[model samples]
Target: MSDQVVPAVINLDVPGPVISRHLYGHFAEHLGRCIYGGFYVGEDSEIPNEGGIRLDVVEALRALDIPNLRWPGGCFADEYHWMDGIGPKQDRPSMVNTHWGNVEENNHFGTHEFMALCELLGAEPYISGNVGSGTVREMSDWVEYLTRDGDSPMVRLRKQNGREEPWKIRFWGLGNEAWGCGGNMSAQQYAAEARRFGTYCRDHGGNKLYRIAAGANSADYAWTETLMKQLGELGCAYRPQPFMQALSFHYYTIPGTWQDKGDATVFDTDDYYRTLAKAAYVDELITGHANVMDCYDPGKHVGLVLDEWGTWWNVEPGTNPGFLYQQNTLRDALVASLHFDIFHRHADRLVMANIAQTVNVLQAMILTDPDTKALVLTPTYHVFEMNKGHQDAASLRVDLPAGVPARETLATVSLSASRKDGKVLVSLSNLDAGAPADVELDLRGGALSGVRARILTAGNLQDHNTPGAPDTIAPRAHDQVTATANGLRVHLPAHSFITVEGRLG
Candidate 1:
């Protein structure tokens, strides 16, 4: 009388929402060779650059510990204009990136080379502002040209484009896909242009900007309930609260429609269960856009910027179909491990997410070759380098056993759990490519000496990792999980993803 599918419990003190090392972010647009042959190769190219960027793609995005990046982007940041990318680079002024792949954007990786590639990948940049063809005084002088410090006139044109200190940039993005190509408005004219570019987006000297509006794409939810009711009535009719701490959204994983977005290296198994049924509908599009932002933010206070997700197929065969080049399978690493286990089970209204690109565009995580520099890392970048130990941890609270069968097709698993620093990880994804689960978890309150585990399977499901055939789908060492007195007992293969790692002591 024990068929056993029970043990799905997890408690680790049952907390949640700490999971935000900017939710393991990373997105960088300007399409096609994602920023001039991926990570700009120009300071007199030799392939292993440093000042011209690309020190092996910044040491492979700082070995995926990449906390936050997002920049000049997604729809090319509303036709970007930061003074056409700072000054002298042979007198910069190139434009014409007219919404990706229309070509010609030689501003040579603008804005002091994307804030010096986010300070050589220590990360945290976020940018994205230009409210559709700009001007609320041109995004308030681009926030005084990257957080002013004095001597105005955009900090003397950002120290005559040579940067004289004054760049702390704390996540801006008030415009991007503003209801499509960042300009169709509506949602109350993009919440009155996110309350006039979030009223100056200032707070310089010491950096205090977190403003982020301009969301809604998939599931729309009435454009996130009319931009959370006209940006919460323009934050109490603009007093000292011109708020807008976050509200961006965008879901990708189009398996049927959007002009046949179905190939990325051809498919099978019913198009890999219809692209894991559209990437498990991003947890019902983040619980129906968080039930319409809990009706104009029921104490959720904004925050939900999934900032454009991944997996958008079709565009690799002979490129230039708009330069969204593809190729990153293992079904895009189980649709990026079911959207990072549904963004750590909605880390309390999802704090941040940015995986639409990191290199070579769409579902990318590194893939280059500026004429033979060669590099490759995909399998969704080894499932974000094996779930980077669940970033800022603490999310612990999993429980998924209602007779674990198949959720009507595939999706046999896609759980989440956290509690880092002192351990308790867990991060499954088995998406059944034909049964192999034996998950039985139940690791409540304590108990967890040393469980280990780590996977990222291949053996065809369009397995990838090119650049001279890399580890052809990486991440190895994975013990089938152990310790079980009604506690641990894993197996999860048959199209894998695993994570495990325990400790509690």
Candidate 2:
């Protein structure tokens, strides 16, 4: 393995937008075991639970300081009828989850259950409304039921269902993938529907909704262009449009073709590099959409939300093909670190991003065994935990000197820095599978001391944790980092992710 010294700079004085805590958000759709066996087991089951929500799962996610969670979709939101999921468990109507595995949905874990889960985790709730098959009035009434108080019909219905006070909710999605599973509508057609549906989803009592319009598929600049043009026609310079506050789109990293996404735990060197390259492409996608948004809304009033993103791979053998269950490895952790670094750089326009799922689905943070009911915290979980310090922190500019080794797939190393609460946190990832990187960080504009570091790596790129060996790929204190005269020096191993924290002097 080669150890080449790489030079970089971190300017503490040149700070950018406060990296939103919501950018580290997560998603929970009613697909696969994500809801039933994953987050919610029956209250009577053997697993430790509080009101049918798994306690172990809640405790594990709480460590990440989870900011918000998007619920009931990817494609399931459009087809879901909110009314069918309310009231007592036995009385609730069951429906076929057509988008997922064609499994029967009992509708037991509905609006109240979700809000309770959010409260247990101390996270904000981001609800995605139905617009494909449901009517405008139905969407409006549902919003009132959750947020409105006093003598309204919907509020009275909520009381009948045993909720006395309205729960405060801010983020609301207009729909899921409007171009495909959400409705199969053209961009122009969906834009008109967004205006009508958003008109009725009014602010109730003191709760104001941040309505986010369903945006383009990956790289669909024309779709974003159309939506922005329509929004421009609706408002003037003095007053911003009231219809929607932000726009959202989805992106996922796949190393191969869609039909044959490569295996998650078993892949060759080519597959490994290709995956990092594809993950790096998200930077371009963000810039392209931002360019279209700047044309009409140059003042940057509207926000860009990457609601659904993560790695997608073929399901494991013997598992149901429709479940979308896949293993997480060191490669997956590197991919997540790469994405977060890119997200920090574009904090000006990108307000939020949620991984495709939180548990037991695509690129999940934790995996559960159905029969044993055990939990395995994946490597990706450690990345989130280590980088949590960057949440709401002022982003610091990181610069790389010339002649650093680079490849067509991805750079040899990736980095990001942010300052918060009198501390500076720098995250670095060595993407090269066979080479080590020795980095000398030139901390400019300020002084720093008391450097401490932690690293997450494994014996092999395909190394992952199972229930029996949960700590196979966890984070450990790194003693290789040393304080320098100017700043600090770090030695990153092959295929590893590290975070350095210090007190700003």
Candidate 3:
């Protein structure tokens, strides 16, 4: 260790924004084994399942306290029709998932199944409606069917199907990607369409609708501004509208351009650093979009929804190119940690952020073998489990002395802290591939009580879990934590993400 001393100070007395539980959310689409074989193994399969969902997967997700789950699609949502998947399993309709794989999608899992899965996992369902291919009446009926408790046609159909009670669904997306897949509409057109769709998104009982407008692609701040401007006009005293609660934004970090996403499992240090460099730009994206929203919504009346955010790597060789399946590595864990810290920093406007396709899909938390009972948690999964306590926790002020920023990337040390109840949770990530970091904590107005830490890291930067050896990467007790006279001291390992939790006495 060098004689130089550098400390990262945290002031407990000075608090930041409160971290919303919805920030720790997930997403699932009707692509690949994400549904058919990934999480749902069918009730008749030899694999153990509860209500046709993998029990092992259920337990793993529940353990993370997964708050919200966006379902049906990434691009698939706009093409999804709710009615086709509700009746008898044998009588259900089938359609080709043209957006994803050109494979036939048997309507076995629909509204009922998704809500049931959310129930099993204790996650709120953030359903995306079909705006591109569906009419306003269709979305109106879908919401009414899932939320109505009164005498209505949708309610009658719900009873006829098997579910008697209506499920409480607060979050709804009017469309997916209106700029492209959903429909090649400009922001003004989509915003007007959002108003029409928002009109019939009626609250059935106490379930208030938080209808979201389809948001921008990466760095399309003009789209955000345009949508917010039109939405501001529509939601006026002369023309009061429904709860257009939030505007959605989709961004995926790619090492190279979309044409060449680079390899997932096989990547050199330069590619790894570039991938992280792209991840570092998430803060810029959020700040840029938030700044636009701030102008239209000075009171912050309309929040920003980072509906989809994660990494998109080149598909594994010999796999279906359409199905976004990739391997998770220590680098992925680092990228995810950086995104979490960024979202936490902007928790005020950032209502909910779901990592793309929760299982067997791009940057999935859990991976399942195609024809086996094997279920393994990725390093990203472990990071989520470790940081679950920060949900709904008020952010603690974090002050990092501005240092020499990485020339190719942003800050090397990514950190965020939150206090819930009497507990303080500090998550730190040292992204340097070769250098370990020694950072001191200056927790003002509080003495060190007890700090327990867990870390997710690996020997090789490319290290990941294989079905044969799932424990190759997992959380272990951190031995580098000790109390300091000023606050606390944490010696962080390189390419690692650690969450140190302590009782704020």
TM-score of each: 0.35, 0.98, 0.97
Best by lDDT: 2
Sort by TM-score, top down from the best: 2, 3, 1
lDDT of 2 by residue, 1-505 (tens): 5697998999987888889999999999999999999999989989999999999999999999999999998899999999999999999989999888899999999999999999999999999999998899999999999999888999999999999999999999999899999999999999999999999999998999999999999999999988888677433362347988899989999989999999998998989999999999999999999988887777788899999999999998888888899999999999999999999999989999999899999989999999789999999999999999999999998999767767774787999999999999999999988899999999999988888999999999999999989999999999999878878899999899999999988
C-alpha local distance difference test of each model? 0.81, 0.93, 0.86
Candidate 3 residue 205 Cα shift, in angstroms, is: 1.8
In model 3, the Cα lDDT at residue 232 comes to 51
C-alpha lDDT (0 to 100) for residue 263 of candidate 2: 96
Q: Name the candidate, 2 or 3, with the larger lDDT value.
A: 2
The candidate with the higher lDDT, 1 or 3, is 3
Output the number of the TM-score-best candidate: 2
**Worst ten-residue run, lDDT, model 1?**
233-242
Candidate 3 wrongly placed segments (more than 4 Å): 1-5, 233-240, 404-407
Q: Model 2, which residues run further than 4 Å from truth?
A: 233-239
